[model samples]
Target: MKILSLPSSIGLASKIAKNIGCGVADYKLTRFPDNEIYTKIDTPLDGEDVVVIGNTNTDSDIMSYLFLLDAAKEQNPKRLIALMPYFGYARQHRVYNRG
Candidate 1:
């Protein structure tokens, strides 16, 4: 079975992978001087199970996650699981304190 994992940094994802004994496929993200973001999955992911782990630290994090999800779908993974530990805009659950 193939497993694809995308983590924000080397600390968390790598540690978890080692603990669980799962092969980790690293995903790279590059930003240009023009402020454009580029992302890539480093391993063959066709027909594999994908798990994306990311914590929300900036506005771009959410966009990055969405991009990864779309890419994962395109890869035709047997299953897609997005494991986001911290979500930033989650506080926008409802409208309150109307002025």
Candidate 2:
């Protein structure tokens, strides 16, 4: 098992990895000129379980998490998991009725 740590959730990722006794995966994240998110997985995740950790505190954070997941999936990991410690959504937990 491996954990892919996003910039905003590095600390949490480390804690989780330590607790789970799993290794942290190597990856790179950058931004484009237009402020787009870019993710690169340096370690191959073939046949490995992957955990992506991040926070959705802003638009970029959400995009970063999505892009990271996509990159991890491309490596063909056995399973993909998401750990969101901080989601900035105001009411995502509540179901809304038709307006």
The segments of candidate 1 whose C-alpha lies over 4 angstroms from its true place after superposition are: 1-9
Best by TM-score: 2
Encode model 1's per-residue lDDT on 2-99: one tens digit a residue: 34443554467677778877777766777889977777776777887777777776778777777777766777788888777777788886779765
Report every candidate's CA lDDT.
0.70, 0.89
Spell out the clash pairs found in candidate 2: none
CA shift of 69, model 2, Å: 0.5
Candidate 2 lDDT over residue span 1-99, tens digit each: 999988788888888889989988999898889877788999989999999998999887888889999999999999999888887785776879765
